[model samples]
Target: MARCPKQRKKAVIAAVSAYLELLFNFINLLLRYYEALESEQEQAVEHVSSWETPIARQLARNSFMRCIVSHGDISCTMLVRMNCRTFQKLCMLLRDEGGLRCSWNIEIDEMVAIFLYTIAHNEKNRQLQATFRRSGETICRVIKLVLRSVLKLHSILLRKPKPVLHNSDDPKWKHFKNCLGALDGTIVNVRATKENQERYRNRKGTIGMNVLGVVDQNMEFIYCLAGWEGSAHDGRVLRDALIRPNGLKVPRGYYYLCDAGYSNCEGFLSPFRGQRYHLKEWGGRRPRSPEEIFNMRHSTARNGVERAFGILKMRWAILRETTWFSTKMVTKIVNACYLLHNFIRGENGADVFERLYVDEDPDEETEDVDEDLILHIQPTVEWSDFRQNLAQELWAARSWITS
Candidate 1:
């Protein structure tokens, strides 16, 4: 039954040869992987060298940095929100000038890319991490670090209003008083959360964000109040603005316009009864007299506030996002947007309202909100000599309250 010696020897030799070949193949694969990693490192070094040159990392981001920095430092998240080029230059400048410490070891671009993809779009952080191959905590760290950087210059950036209307007839805002601008509030739609459903419930019976803002006659946001819960009354919001004595200072002889919800005083003004008693019990539906015409003019002028609010909502549609963020962060986000708006506009780019303020007629061809329809708009009196006289006649003149 024994096999031939030549046949057994041939089988043993074949098995040994196969094992040797497999070992060689595995060794080749490992060598190739090392070579690939080396090449990647060389490419990274080249990229950093190009960016390190005196040449701007990104002109747009650099320009934005230059502009905003005049006021103070800005956040990296905000910088990332800048155009790609802008972010590079901004980060470069921070490395060069800010003496800021970078906590994440990744290149500025990776951090910028992650945040840019986030706030600019409504994508979740998890999706961003997958696409960019980053961890959740790293993403969170970069965002917080940038916001903290931006907050440092808050004093210089978020300052009190000074009457820049240096002259009564200055061409700039043309005779607007101690007023930095008119103050007002609006509601943004939000999603209801289980814990705060009852709290954020608006009159429309849906959850939403309520924001209060102050803008100049030209529609530039001078300040804002973003922390109030949506369910808070407008009166309560106005009162809060007053309480921020150090926060929002309305210079003497300056004032903010308000609807009836606000308590009328010297620093603030409201229209006479106008034959209409209140919201539910307003008078018959029509503008019948000169007083009504005056009221129409008053409401027409104040519509600027509505226009400003509309632009803000339009700019950051995410304000309409249903998810909840900490109220504190939400407020900062709102301020950040306001500052950015002024930043991008680059000096009067968005001053249509300001132009409309002093002009008797900017758009003659477009019909003024149908005169007949004007009846529905409420009346508000300017708190100048006219307000004083009207108040005197009604014996409701308020002399106690002063700005």
Candidate 2:
């Protein structure tokens, strides 16, 4: 049964080769399994994503910046800074909440992007609309719709005047005795498009928009009107302040402040005539004395309306002009901006003009009694005369009622 040495050696070599081959095949199989496991694990991670909200659920800047810019931040193109989810929500709100959608199924982001690019940045609608895969008409409609929503939601953000709280507490505004808010006029310039050039022309002899706004001491817009033609005076505009039955509210003893553009008629007040815009003019070497220094301090505090206008116009360049917004939407856009301004200030601490770098006048000139230029003053109603007449009527009426 013994075998030859050479044959045994040959058999051993064959076995060794066979073992090496088997080991190689086993390693290959393990490699394939590991690769498949990795693939499966990746698919699982993709499919089994955690359902909870991501820590980075930030609101898109557009949804927030539009409001902020108008009342407070006064920045341009806040759209680029927003998150995708928030951008989508804004598109949905404009489309769904505001019901502004066109035939193209243009999304909210595209629409908002169009506005931020066009109106806020003063880019042509055709150019911006094209970038977003939308038509110019769609862009126009989108802008109008947003303006409408802004107007619709203007009062929603207003902090109700807290009369119950004492006047001494919130020095930012005028409380109980009188003063609902501030009143002011702003001109929104527009290119004289041939279609309705005359209709848009204002007293300034330019085709522009005239808007009247009322804001509280906090600079929150309480009410706004945008329909008046540019030629309308501030007096006529103020008369209609109490017109809107539901949207407008003015409690008794509450009034507003405006410049000489408005009459000091029954419900409003202005600086004393021969009044210098800056009361410091009174002490100057001018012929006539001006208002006291305290008046300047008070007027400056009440002049938030001018600040609001500057903020709005500077941020949304279109606001400085007659917006292509529909006439009805004109008011809404204005209201919305004011409302959002307030919202951003309250929620985001947005300061519209500070961002714009509004400056104080160091050598600004004030009118000192120009003799050649006659000062037209608003006729005042003597309180004593008015009250005596009112008292006589009351006494006579009482005797008649007694009888």
Candidate 3:
């Protein structure tokens, strides 16, 4: 059972060497793992730092500027809804009068373009953000800034009422020589909450606002009073307008042609109540009575307001579609369109107006959408005589023509 000393020594040395080798390998593995852990921690810190860094804004200014310059006329008229000269004029107004000097790298021209494009095309914030290469918040802010700027030009855009000189030479307007303009109301669709829906609902069960406007012979809006609920009667709205501090007014000798929705009173003239008055009533048929002749002339002169409304609705699509905006904002939009309509007409000539009216038959002339039941009014002796005299004059003029 006893082993030799030499053999026993050799076995002990072999076991000790094996244990040392194992210890060395374990220490090397620990070092490698620590290095890998340190590298991962460094990478995590780098990733966190990168998120805090801000990126420069990309405005796409050159691209947009080039597009506008390349197709300058189209961009100015169709896209921006104004001629180049007018656009520049507005830009100046926004800077000086509107107090909208560009800040934070937003140019005045860009702000105006954004506002016009948004309303003219009825584009959403997201669409504008994508198109202009800007953020949604930036696009929205710019639109508001330019909107307020454009609205500042209201006093300049809206015309002042002036008397038309009496003339007997032109048959078309000779009878209306003293007429200042034509007055009418239009309905624009809008979105309202359930609580306010009834107030905004029209007879057709659609939410809308009744806008009263007066247009001169030049088809320029002289006065506009919007924000009346669709349920509000046109006559009531007009009455309110007459009482406002800066509302519609007619000089002693001047009057505005109105439909039956308005009462026949001083400073306001209306056609015969129970007679053929609308333009369609005389198509391909001569007027049968003197009252008919007067109505025809009255309707012809009143077409100015109808044509103005048509032009306004055609130019701004935002008015046609129901928008998710507050009632106040919608009212402002309507006013802004009216103001701009006058501005465009003043800047451009009658040809531009005629072109926009092409192929579009005039809408049926009506003062109110819900004026079917005419309200009878007992006119004062003076007003009654005035209307009778006017009608008689129209009849006498017609007799002269026939003879």
Candidate 4:
């Protein structure tokens, strides 16, 4: 088995050569496997992209959905929705007065359309996102921004309650020269958590918010107080309205015609409790007494507030539906609606409704004045005498009618 030294050396060299060749082969195989994996990954990426929609096409679709033609469809009903020209005026106010043009570069027309659509249809944020071709976040942000902007116009939109001059010769208002306006409360449907449902429920067994409002002769809201519990009495709500810093303020010699739910105090005049007060009850017959005549006239004047509320509810469906908003937010929205109602009435006049009152068109049905629900506040001696004297004056003014 002994070999020559040269032969042993050759055999060792051969084994070494074989081991080196095997290591080189394994390295080449690994390099080829990595190259194949990278090629497969590139192909998968290309396949995925081939099925994707083009960015330009998607943008075109969004533009078509939010085009001017779409807005025209909205404008068709803008009169009943936002009382006609009010929608345009509101957008101008936000863009110019509220500084929205500087703060947010969103289109002013689109902003107004979004806001009115929300109120008129009572739409949710997600629903608006789809309709406006905007993201949910943008829809929410725009709504909040526009709402605050509209509220900034509150001071100017709210008209100051002015007294009728003694020498004024307007027949419709000459009879009640000292009257400031009509005051009343209306129930607006709302939504709340189960724990708070009982507190928000009214006598009608529905969740609601009690909204107290005062409207001038032109059907413009002078003062609005919202957020009261639905279960609270109308008189209690009025008391709270009086205590607020900007609450109702009746100047001396000016009174508001209210319903039986309010106290017949010096600043507020209510109809005779035991007598017929509604115009329907009179039914074309002459009043039997001075008190009956006063009640008839009081009912006629106080109807301004009811007509305002009716038009308001008809314009904004949000007031009629149960909104999925917190009670506080709902209150703010209610206040915004009142301010907008005043803005519309001031800008467009009182043509929002064809016949606001039942008496205006006897064929039209309207809200009846509730004379049975009496607040138990005892009238002051001076207050009682003032009402009695007012009734006598109204009766004495009948010389023109009788003649």
Candidate 5:
């Protein structure tokens, strides 16, 4: 193996170079393996994420389905404020008539259920998101869509008033022939911008909108006007309603019974001022005067509107509280509530909300009419005489019954 010195040096250099080359190749292979492993991990993570989304969505949908189907009708009513049958019918109406279509992930029934649950319970967006297993944006969009759909049914939902006929045998309305309904204004809470808050501040010093509602003897709303500032007098609101082209319409002879807050105009009847009115004032006591007798009967007959408002507020919790929507949206919601109320009353023979009001008077307090405020439409002399004659006739009828 002995060799020359230069030859041996050359052989050692070649061996060292070969070793360095082999080391470089081995390092390249290790880098390629590491990159491949990292790519596989990323693909695996993407697959899991994509797979979990649909699974989670499916689970949420299944849970909602179980709540609707397996929980029974009581739970359904408790959740959405209506029986299952009514809920289904409402959904069908919205789809068939209202042009409501289902979203990719949510069904028509689920969309309606979301809206009903939100209004019935006044649930917040976050709560709705959690309950419906949707994002907050999705929840808000669904609410608006369903609200529009429900409002589209207003024409059918709002009842057409049938005046009390002359041959009416019902004691509550027999005394007042050709009476169309009862008209009153209620203050519904609303949240407005800082600049508009003062205008909405009512006499009670609360931010609200004065809602004018006209309901028939059956407690069905015939007309509704909402969005007037609370500080606006009821008389002022009524005046506006009268002037609007599509506003409250009164037949020539038919009249609506109103509290003294309204003027005793030609088509509106108001009880005598400076006299004891309201049923509570005459409870368990005989009417001492003809005026008192008239006021008692007037209050009893007009109680239908009050009870309708009570049942409406009780059924929909959103009406009882300040809504988070904009002023315009709140007005729409108020109208939608009225429409739903009429629909429920017309469809259901037995209403749970109405039952809760049996033998119970509404909590709304009556305020004295501002004579000066209502001077524009002064009490017509003819209508005043008619009221007096009616009062005298009622007094005589009471005496006859006693005798």
Candidate 6:
């Protein structure tokens, strides 16, 4: 449609203006839609956050802590495996000596309580998160943190052994003069990679670590060596412990009573091999010979280590079960258990677990000591003669008493 030049130009200008107006209207509509969407998104975020407000979380945490603190000794003891007084003292010691500080959202007591609850119950991170009202990450971090703090107290918590004196009147210990304590090895289950599992497997076909524990007559741990493979022999582990710079220290002329798994060396006293060495075997019968009497007394004195191990396992459920933590962490947990055991024994008067679990008669069966395996230290002639002489003295003393 050819028209006059001025009329065509006016029509073209009007059409262009109409198109521009339409474009502006479309842009305005899009801007309004985007603004409405952003407002809705903001409202949705607020709604989600309102479900767990800071005040609400704080209240929940406070309520949980109040239940632990206010509820009597049974609640605290069952949960943390320690009475309220001991738990509070432990927290104070950790804060003052271990340098554990309260975090922004958590107190030191709460952190320690979390760690104790986890170990006492062998709880998983998810379980801890639900119980403590924390995230898994937070639970993991605090567990590790509290673990490290407890470890720092090893030097102070570990008891120093006092050798049995010459004039000792305790019937069980009086015979073994200059004896420090009893040392033995036990298997503790651990989780390892498939590649390393075979190395950790013990003769019983269990994947575990061999833990060497030395306990005084009072059933307090004096020294502990952990992390050895379960396949390791008790003597081999003891040798490693002796050679290490910070290993067990046995004074000159003093010895530790050991099971027949160890050699009768200079500083270790083991019962006569091929003889009745267990107290159960001596039940309902008097000693028929010097060796039997000596063995009976040795068994009585050395059973303290067994009781200590039993109490340790009974108190800490983590030790009884296979730990799911890494191998390194499991070792630390074992050490922590030893430390706590000593602490509890020293601090708590009349331990309820000890009263309940420790058998007064101690009729538990003993494993047959391996007589064929070569030990790190070969049996010494002098030590053997000394044991014979000691047996004779014990038999003579008993005969005099009967006479």
Candidate 5 or 4, higher TM-score? 5
TM-score of each: 0.57, 0.59, 0.78, 0.75, 0.82, 0.82
Tens-digit lDDT string for candidate 6 (1-403): 7799999999999999999999999999999999999999766444334327778767777887776778888888888888888989999999998889898888998999999998899988766766777777989999899999999998899877687878889878999997889999999999989999998999999999999999987888889999999999998999998877777877656789999999898889999888898878877778878998899999999998988898889889999999779888999999999999988877887677887786573201113222333224557888899999999999988844442
Q: In candidate 2, what are the lDDT values of residues 280-385, reduced to their tens digit?
A: 4546533222233324434664667777777666656667755554555555555566655565455444353546645541101112222332123234575224
Best by lDDT: 6
Candidates, ranked, TM-score = 6, 5, 3, 4, 2, 1
lDDT of 5 by residue, 1-403 (tens): 7999999999999999999999999999999999999999776443334335767766876788667656877787788877777788888999998899997778899898888888898888866765776777889898899999988998778777677778888778889997878999998898899999999999999999999999987888889999999999999998888777677777666678999988888889999999989877876888878898999899989988988999999999999999788889899999999988877776665788888877542201123222322213557789899999999999988944452
Total clashing pairs for each candidate: 4, 12, 0, 0, 0, 0
The local distance difference test score of model 2 is 0.54
What TM-score would candidate 5 get against the native?
0.82
Name every residue pair that clashes in candidate 3. Answer: none
lDDT of 1 at 369: 22
Q: Mind giving the per-residue lDDT tens digits that candidate 1 earns over 184-297?
A: 777765555589877878888877667888765555566777767789997677666656644455544555665556655656655445454232242444444434433433
- The true-versus-predicted C-alpha distance at residue 13 of model 1, in Å, is 39
TM-score of candidate 3 to 2 decimals = 0.78
Against the true structure, candidate 4 reaches a TM-score of 0.75
Can you tell me which runs of candidate 3 are displaced by over 4 Å? 1-59, 168-171, 351-353, 358-378, 399-403
Model 1 error, position 144 (Å)? 1.8
Count clashing pairs, candidate 1: 4
Model 1 scores a TM of: 0.57
The alpha-carbon lDDT assigned to residue 334 of candidate 4 equals: 86
Considering lDDT, where higher is better, how would the candidates rank from best to worst?
6, 5, 3, 4, 2, 1
